[model samples]
Target: MRLELLYFFFYSMTVYILETNGWPQQGKHELRWNHSYTGINKPSNPIDKEVLEEFYHSTAGPAWLNNAHWLSGDPCESKWYGVGCNPSGDVVELDLSNNLLAGELPDRLSNMKNLEVLILRHNAISGTISPLLFTMKALRVIDLSYNKLSGSFPPQIELPFLTNLSLSNNQLEGYLPNHWNCLNLEVISISSNMLQGVLPNGLSTLSSLKYFDVSENFFIGPFPKEYSSLTSLETMWLFTNRFNNSIIPESWNKLVKMKNFQADSLAGNLPELIGVNWSDLEVLIVVDGHLTGDIPESFCHLKKLKYLHLFRNSLSGPLPKCFCDLPTSSLVSINLSYNQITGTVPDCFDNFRDLRYFYMENNNLTGTLPRSLSACKHLYTIDVSNNYLVGSIPSLYANLKDTLNWFELDNNRLNEIEDGLEDFIVTLSTKFCSLYGNPWSCPLPNYFSGKEYCTARCSSCNTLEQHSSCEKCLTSTSNCGWCADGRNCLEGYTNGPYYPYHCDQSEWVFGNKTNC
Candidate 1:
């Protein structure tokens, strides 16, 4: 028992030492701190202490995290939570990201003379951006995104050493600070704000700027022309905003390096600006805008467009049949609904073996659904409602029967879709099948209950068509009498809307006054 107690004591001591800041446990040799700062035990600057304490106590601080005093007993120990100090014990990097830090910026943070990186993202840090804080000129990176910080930006405060700046997902409002051109700025995202007014000109002079996203705001008026000078710019996202201006001068084709372009709500039709060497164009979502006219056939020029959504506009004419003709490797979703599109669904759709979602509803496309629809090896959902398509649907489901989900054709002229269509839709009730506007002899599948017939067929047409054995069929061993004169009924199936034959001149219609 005495030996066991001695072993326990040594094990506990080793664990405690390992958990703290120190060197290896190879027979006990304590590690020391190396202060990189110039001086030691200098007089505390009140403002600097306040800022440091604020950072220490903020959500990005270590005090509230784990509640263990990280700076207890000595200052020359291991790395503190969300903090990094040099050998001389001067804070160099403070990353208190995703902490629930609440309150204002403490001015003492500016006193960390050697501090380089300060990341306080995804916290509750509030209040205005301190203008006096930029004096630390050695500060290189600042990421304070996804916080509740409000108020406008201060002007003229320049950080010559700053490289990455992310103030996105905050309550930041008012015009952006001008004249502080961050030439070394590489990534800037001020998205999800109330920022208004014309984007500051000369912004293109920041030649090193790479990722620029000011999307989702109330900014209006004409598109900025100075942006054309950003030759090195790559990803520019201005989607979901009131930037109700035209897509700038015809020279926008010069954005050669742009890849993912999404001006979905930006107004105006697609200019002839396409058909150029936008070789890197991957996603061109100019949909849900004030776009008019038909998609230009020249769209085939974009060999790199993987996802194209030009739906929800006044676009007319036959859908460019060649849209799905591109390489089928990376296509995702294409929504061209709620428009004035006409003409039959192009057979070129057969090439889209990789299509997952294809929506071309609410158009004037006539004729039967193409039989080649069965060839789409990967199609999942199809929306062809409110069109002029007629005829019966083919049994085209040996491929999609297992994978297909929504097959909606509400206002088309379809009735007697083959038995497999009904069975497939009924078996997969939540996912597959719909028919609302056709007039033909179709029965309800047993899986569909509580309703006898689709109201669209029964109410408006005022006719119930059904096939039944007749008294006089071509190959039946039965004799029939056709008293073809007065008070005679029209020839029909033996099992129709009526069992015994009868005739009434008042409501007579369809195939002569047919009686059931």
Candidate 2:
């Protein structure tokens, strides 16, 4: 019996050496010999092996892009692809992101009790997430974004160690889970989903939260003012939702660490305290809202601001002159179009060295185009169309010939182009230039005679009966002026009428002169 035992021990030791040293022919023999052996080649706990094999089979193991040694050998002992294990042989991490992983997550994945990270983003995995997966106590990160997962969020989440959870770009619907109590959680993004209902006030307890996004959904009702308690928040996106009649919570001023904040279709004026408190703010977009009131001058204090978009609102009043104090090095884009704001474009742009886009179209602004705008050497778009701006186009605009693409001065009261800018205007018109309603005196290139540019003309203005008042007459068209002597309206340039038709030169009141 001693002789037989010694021979068996020697045989097992030789097989182990050959299998582990890449001797494939001998290793295959060893695998067959130890196919049922559960000592050194299998998981310490039998349940872990069963769970891993089940997950492989349920998720279509053979079809995976990188299914190296899955199911053919011990998961932990043979180093299966994308599988990680703790020293005790428990599965700890499974990162198969963008690995062409398809099919639904097997319910048995919950058996990975020791899993700390599960990243399966950018895959085709579908079906509702199993609630059992959240029961894993050791989970620290879970990113299943860019998948086809649907159904409502899991009802209860009690993970104490989870720090990141992203389910963006999914088809999930229904209200967000309200019972989540992940105290240490820091990032939660469920944007681009169909979730609805008022934001849960319970999220106020997540003091450690830093990033939260729920945009592009059907969520309605007032934003949770309690979320102001998340002072650690750095980014928040709540746009493209149905938060009808909801106003930004005034308490949000307490979130002083904010770097980016965006929302749409909300009601109420922008809170002044946001500019006062959020000194680190970089991007602020609140478009298509019922916002009314002057843009707070305090916004000039946001020295780090880069993008400012407040279009399609009822906001009126002149832009604050203090905007010249805005950080020149950081500002990039500004869009305040489709509002009732009235004032001359601020010539404070000389210091905006990095400015690119400037859009203030469809406003009530009246003034000569500021010569200071030419100081921005990198400007790409300058759209001030549909306003009451008049005067010669600045000759300095020729400096932006190479960078400018979309130059729209259409439907304005502009009359002439400065002498040396013909080439620049020709180049711009070939792009997105619009110089239609203006009555030009200086000759344009023959290019304007083309049918496509027929509206770009120097014709005498036609008289209209709608000029009932001097102010109304000036805005009627570029050439229509009010004659004070006889209270008559006639077509004329700032110097005098083209036909000298019953209007004395001294009695003319047009252009910027309000004395009719």
Candidate 3:
């Protein structure tokens, strides 16, 4: 029996076969990865060294990407580089947005099938999307915005789990996909595309789609009646299309969930707000459309209305007294640019305290600028250009102090600058003001030259290096706070040399000077 046992043991040792243990370690040389790695702190493969290596190599190489330490296969933190992980050693999220990676996406991306969220926005990646991608079954969010991706989206696409897909600012062409049964897709943005042809009727069946933007496309004809079924739709931006010949569907009033509703160029008048349930509507923007007739009187029902943008349309009539009262109660912005509305800005505008932005430029409203406008205490942005209104500037800043950040009263009949116009000088001294086009006296006001305008305005030379719009700060939610050092909050904004410039006690002059 001893001889038989010895022989069997020797045979087993010679075979050297062992069952695979989970990702912890593979002997001393082979490391295990993809363990819970805390799901985020480690690679999911649980047994590979190349995961982090590939991550840093491919993702624009952010500063924190260098500090990542690997304890076996797990990383230590996600806020370091927008990395997320699942229970296994797999990387489930990678959001290296606006990190400015240059060049085309590498084809080796097929390796990350476990990724659920992939945000690679504001980079300079050029080239068509790779067909060699992993089926990406787990991908829920994909934001490749402001990149240089061109070519038609793959027809046989297989991303069933995708929810938020923002492919804006890319050069993608071809008609929008006609059929998609993706029940889970919520936000799909293909704005600023060259896509042509009518939307397929089947698209309206995507009841779960909350935000669908096909703006700036070549789509023509009436929006199909089926669009009314999208009861869950919240933000529907269908502007700048060739649908001017189409009738504004009366069923549009059913978009009760619509908040940021924008649909311009559909020929017709707005329906009366009596039966319309725009009660939850915050932003009612319809610009450059063919809608004519007076501003809807029933619009006063929107107690929640904040922004009312009705620019570049043929709509006529005086501002309704009720409309002024409600917007004053709740609205922050009111734009009626490029319209034929005549008569004075409702004197009731004086009651608006939340009014931040007010633009009635290029309208035929004939009268002196209302002195009551000065009463909107929170007024920060104002543009009343190209109008027939004549008066010395209302001197609203005397009351606002410094809350007035943006003020444009250009191309009006105002013949003189304000007495305290030098205060605007302080704005030009820093980097937060724009004033021009109003006729000023020869012995030019105070600080801020026309050259200052030339320098301060985002010139063609500086725009490439700098963001033209607020996009730089807008992309990041917590950026650009004036109370704290703006340099600390925003990357490009600087008041002084970098220590990242924390707004110390010295930056504040409290007693009488408030930091508005």
Candidate 4:
């Protein structure tokens, strides 16, 4: 019985040895990599190591691709670049962002079953996203933006755990996939793509979605009515798309947390009290649209609002009267240019203490330049041209000489520049301030006479740069003289060491001085 037992055990051991050695017929060194390894801070397990080696080699092997650690070495032990692993040595995150990697994502990527984050953004990667990736339930962030990826997205893709999915600036075409119910998704940026078709209502179903940007797409839309249900949304950008229908303000009633809303070229009327529900709104830009109506008085309720851009619309009526009454207002930039807005320019500058850019150009506004604007020390640019504004310009602004870089007051009915403001005008860089297309008397102040719109009163130069055509009749000589540094000077003036001298030309002529 003892002899039989020993013979049987030896027979079983021989069979085992033969079976293992027979695998070498497939490949010799290949089978050596299948061995199990164990240690603290060791390389990734054999399964993950094999998967990563396939990926690196499959990807375009650039000269800068120095990740030899992921090929044969243990990734956790050698600290493979952009590879993160868990305590048990399982690869969990692979971030190769901005690496200039130039290749399509390999098909075997799904082998990393434990991966949670895959960020390959700003690469030259091309190809359709593998549907296998969406099946990876552990993935939380999948950012493949700024790639050359091209292909229709797979329909009905499901990524249950995804939180941020950014595929912007890719060559991805076709309608967005349908029935996407990623409840944990907080951000979905697919802008700057060729994504066509009406925006799906399934997007609003993402209860945790905070930022959704589909701008610069071919999305035809009667914007999804279910978008009102996106209570968690803080920013929504639907700009530069070819939407068919106008926005319904009531459909956005539940978005109280919304802060930034931009929809350029969208057709809609200014809802009377949009601020009633969007009280937390901060930036609202709806430019180049068919919007019409008075500025909403409810805009005053947005205490945190900073940028209000309603430019190039048909919005009529005076600026909202209540804007000045809002005590907590934080307005800094307000653009309402090229609109049909009527009524005198309102003096709400006192409320916009932080005002930097104020554009009301090409409207039908009629009024004197508001003195309140002079008190806004931060005011840098103001364009109220092409209006019926009468009265002389303000004598001075708080930081007009320094901060005010652009001031456009042309095409108005102004009769004169304020007497004391001539010095300020002379110090200003020419063409930064346009004071023409009005009824200034001929032989205008040398500073203002250089503009082409001032041609009715003076020999003006049409171009802003190199005003060689603006020769002036000097008081000292009946012969025409060249204007340099806002001063009328003889032709040889530039030959002097101090060529373009500060003649205080405008003040000399208009400020009761006699150096003209």
Candidate 5:
């Protein structure tokens, strides 16, 4: 056999010249392409076919919605559709995400230069981010997120093999590049965009960072206790930024691989050593910030906490009976609303059992209402409204009548309503059951005589009439009753149904009486 057919025709002509010119010391066979070399007739690097025909005539590639096999030839052997080359055909991954790629982003896309994953995300493109595409150092995932990209941030970014960088919701403004050499960054999402200064302690030198989102944007100062050296951070989104009053850096309790931390309008104090070293924290959002004391019984050591939003802060004491030793099947949604928090509400919700949305609204909370939250059975929206809570409403909350929805007890100091929770508050939905300013007990409970149930001060407290003052008959109705001798707005108390007969019953003055 003629020497094995000349060694099988010199190994199929050295694999067709290393797949048509590449690897001859990478001189790419002197940039071939001069006819009859069919590998779909073009691009063995004619500068990647003139930068993919100038990125398909600068991004409008015939109003692309998948301009498949674009420009008709060898964009990586004619399989163009989001071109992804590399077996030495070179162009490596340019996924045209959401392919409606509208214009701008063609500084000849830095002539592809062996791109490594450049996804034009949710494209509608738009101007400004082509410092020659950051001089292509073989990028690793640069997702121009929800594009419409505006200028700034590129006062020198080197990308040393970037690992996931998403330019979030663009219109990007300046500041942010105070030094970060990528160092194999792991997800940096520039959020909402309009970027402002501070927050660059050189990103705590990356250390293989893990998901850092510069939220909402206008970032101001402080929060950088050198980011406690990232230690492989896990999901951090500094929300609605304006870090003017910084604070959260109890040396970030050495991040212990934090899992989801959100910050808004920063000031601080929730750092009781991050609930004993993060313990793989799961979602903690500090809201409308200017946070004050308490809240930290070392957060019952997190045991995988699930969503706790401390709202409108100025936090005060009580509420943390070691949060009933957290880990009640990973509690879901607890918002301490408009905080000024005071005691009560901690009846250790009988092993929460995956509680769902419970907000302590307008806090100043006081006792009564906790039949251990009827063991939560997936409760949905239970707002403890304007608290100062006094007894009555908890007839074991009718075991949340099949996953309750929005049951807010309004302006509290509640008087009564216990027997079988009045058919679960009359099958909720008088705008989701919001019983007004309590003190009930005036022949008024036939499920609160449905004037669409509760509030017109519970059907106008027996038609309030002669109230010459006792603060206008107890401010008109916790069921009236005031008569210090004919100040008469009587509805109850001393068996009132309009009791006056020359008013006396020991000068009546019932329920929350405003001094007579």
Candidate 6:
């Protein structure tokens, strides 16, 4: 057959000289307008066009694509910069995101065989990521996130119609690929990578996963007990990693369409009906986790909770006074600082009328301070510092002295401060009141400015003169003029030279100063 037609004409002229741009013959390749796609060449394969001119002449992609518009024309009919083509000329989408495109990352782009979307995000694209790009099976969205890409990560992910897989902040390390079935995966972010081992179970067969982030990465054990049955999981970020798991997998209550669950140092307890299956949870962070019991009163059935971080942890009883009788109208910020919580303080701010940040600082809480929190007219911040509180300081915070900004009642056992809220702490100008270890009385240094009015041991107990020599004497060098069942009369001590002066009339002076 005439030598089989001369070996089929030398294999179609060596595949048409490796598909155009004059195959590796070095130099002399100017094609700016000698252009000719043969009348709009409808090529359904065969126009590798030297795979994007050898990926714009080996990497640095002509400094962000425009080398005179990609060496002039026909990159699938001239529309480049984030190229996308189809109608037979192939090359389906390649968004060079944040296009400051630096070097590396050009494994002939897996020869674009109908490539379906490969966004090089925030490019500065460094090396290592070409495992022939998961053999591109018409890849569906593979974002090389925040590039600076290093090695590892492509052990096996066959990309069967892949759905949004972002190699987050790359520097990607090993582990992870146990074969993510890729069954139409739905959003998988390898967050801040430096990825370590464990986390494989082929990702519980990604049943159409809905946002899964391996946060901050260094991923260690625990987390993949079939990922709480992934019922189309809805946003899960395993924070900071090194996951020394203590427990959070009670089959995660079969994730009833979970809505944002953050984790780091996750320890036990917290599953007490977790708001009856996370009633469409809206941001629940488990901080410094090692969480212990009591916080559940079914979390008042999370009516779409709006940000509730369980601070520090070792949680104890008393904060579920129906959690302010829930229906908190979409509560915003309620951090329970350092736990071991005990009773009182829940006057239920008239059901937190859209309350803003209220942390129960260092718990063991005890009564008085909740004058129904002035019905939270968008209360700013009120931290109950070192608990065991007692009355006064809540003159309805003078209607939240214009959106009160942090009022931390330092070391409690509080005693008097209300001369009707002392002009809400002398006209607040960016409030921050922390009455150090209370015993009150000491606001008159020209009524505020600096330490806001107390502490220097309440300004040396306001130059002493009975207010129990500086608020019911408890060391300012104890003038202890009676009260602890020495039969009252210690409201700011009186009887001329303090002593058995048991002057009770509910003794709480320091302003109208009488009955001593």
For all predicted structures, in order, the TM-scores are: 0.73, 0.80, 0.64, 0.77, 0.35, 0.35
**Residue pairs of candidate 4 with colliding backbone atoms:** 42-77, 43-74
Best by lDDT: 2
> Ten-residue segment with the worst summed lDDT in candidate 3?
19-28
Better of 1 and 2 by lDDT: 2
lDDT of each: 0.58, 0.75, 0.59, 0.67, 0.72, 0.67
Q: Is candidate 5 or candidate 6 better by lDDT?
A: 5
> Candidate 4 at residue 324, lDDT?
76
lDDT per residue (tens digit) for residues 1-516 in model 3: 974463344223212211111111101111112223233544346322255456465545544323344333344333234566665656776666656665667665656767777777767777887756426678777788778888776554456787777887788887766666567878878777677788777677677888877877778877887888888887777776798747657776677887767666656776774225766787666766677878777888777777677776777887766756475666777778778887778666777877766778777675667767678887765667666555465555556546766665555434344677565546534634433443233334445455574122221211222222233323333223221222112222324212222234433222221342
In order, what is each prediction's RMSD in angstroms? 16.0, 17.2, 23.1, 20.2, 22.4, 22.2
Residues 318-434, model 1: lDDT tens digits: 867665556566555566776788877765556666666677776667767877767777777677877767666677754577767777777665544565665555544556566
User: What tens-digit string does per-residue lDDT give for candidate 6 at 179-231?
Assistant: 77578988888788898877888788888898888877888867767777678
Task: Locate the minimum summed-lDDT window of 10 residues in model 4.
Answer: 24-33
Each candidate structure's count of clashing pairs? 13, 0, 20, 2, 0, 4
RMSD of 2: 17.2
- 2 or 5, which is superior by lDDT? 2
Cα lDDT tens digits, model 2, 19-67, are 4433221101110111112233445356777887887776777888898
Please give the lDDT score at residue 114 for candidate 1: 69
Tens-digit per-residue lDDT, 1-516, candidate 4: 974463344333322322342311100111011112323375577888888777776666444345545544678787777777777888887777767677677877888888888887777888787778778888888888888988777786577888888888888889987688588998888888898998887776788998888888899868777888889998788876797446755778888898878776666677644688888887777766788878888888888887777777788988777767653346777778878888787666665677777888889887678878876777777888888676667776534666677788777655445556655665454547776665333345565555543233322221222122232333333323443333323222322212222232332232112333
